[model samples]
Target: MSELSSPGGEMRLDKWLWAARFFKTRQLAIEAINGGKVQVDGQRAKPSRSIRPGSRLEIHKGSLSWTIEVLAINKQRRPATEAAGLYVEDEASREKRQEIARERRELGGQPQEGRPSKRDRRMIQRFTGRNEPSD
Candidate 1:
């Protein structure tokens, strides 16, 4: 009775995303899905796509990415720790994230989280040997 008869009784992409705390609102999840930021089983997905237990989700948000395997489906959003229980992160992706973060740290931590001043830019340009900087 749960196959074709379940009106998404399990979970949908947007709901899962919201419940998983990836997005603060279902609408945002939907938008992200429609914008191709959410992938189901390695293919791009829509917000209303039905998701069952054991499904894989690949999510991209700006510089962040996650690969999670669904273990349960819930309609309501849960607390952080509770929401975290719904999926197992792909080991490779986790490792890749860590590696990328480490590389970013070694590369000096993501642009200082602010705009660069002219002096900063000049200093960087000079230090990196990009040009003679108009003598």
Candidate 2:
């Protein structure tokens, strides 16, 4: 069996999160753990906490959350497809996340695509009563 799928292996929570693609970097995972955005078995966990297969994790990031059970341990970060095999997210969590995403899309308040054009900037300046020397 691959080391990643070894039944009794243990790995640091932060390293696992990074390898599982939950966070872009181990530092981010550490920060989230310290900030109380990550929990193990419904209790706050430290970045260095050792986790094994079957450990339940609760992670909250912005408007999305995940409740998942660890399925494997990977020491190195992997592609998203492979990373996904490390954990199994709860069905309610998945549905809630999708519903929130759909609501955000339907709300129709997308941010401005990019920096405003010169004319657009001028209009904004005028509307906000903040005029400056024209370029």
Most accurate candidate by TM-score: 2
lDDT of 2 by residue, 1-135 (tens): 255555568999999999999999899999999999999998999999999999999999988999999988887887888888889999999999999999998998977798998999889999989898456
How displaced is residue 5 in candidate 2, in Å?
A: 3.6
* lDDT of model number 1: 0.81
The list of candidate 1 runs beyond 4 A from truth reads 1-9, 112-135
What is the TM-score of candidate 1?
0.70
RMSD in order of candidates: 6.8, 3.7
lDDT of 1 by residue, 1-135 (tens): 212222224777898889889999989899899999989998988788989887888898878799988877766676788778778898998998898788888988555668888889888888899856565
Provide the clash count, candidate 1: 0
TM of each candidate vs. truth: 0.70, 0.83
Candidate 2 residue runs with Cα over 4 Å from true position? 1-3, 110-120, 125-135
Instruction: Give candidate 1's error at residue 66 in angstroms.
Output: 1.6
lDDT of 1 at 119: 88
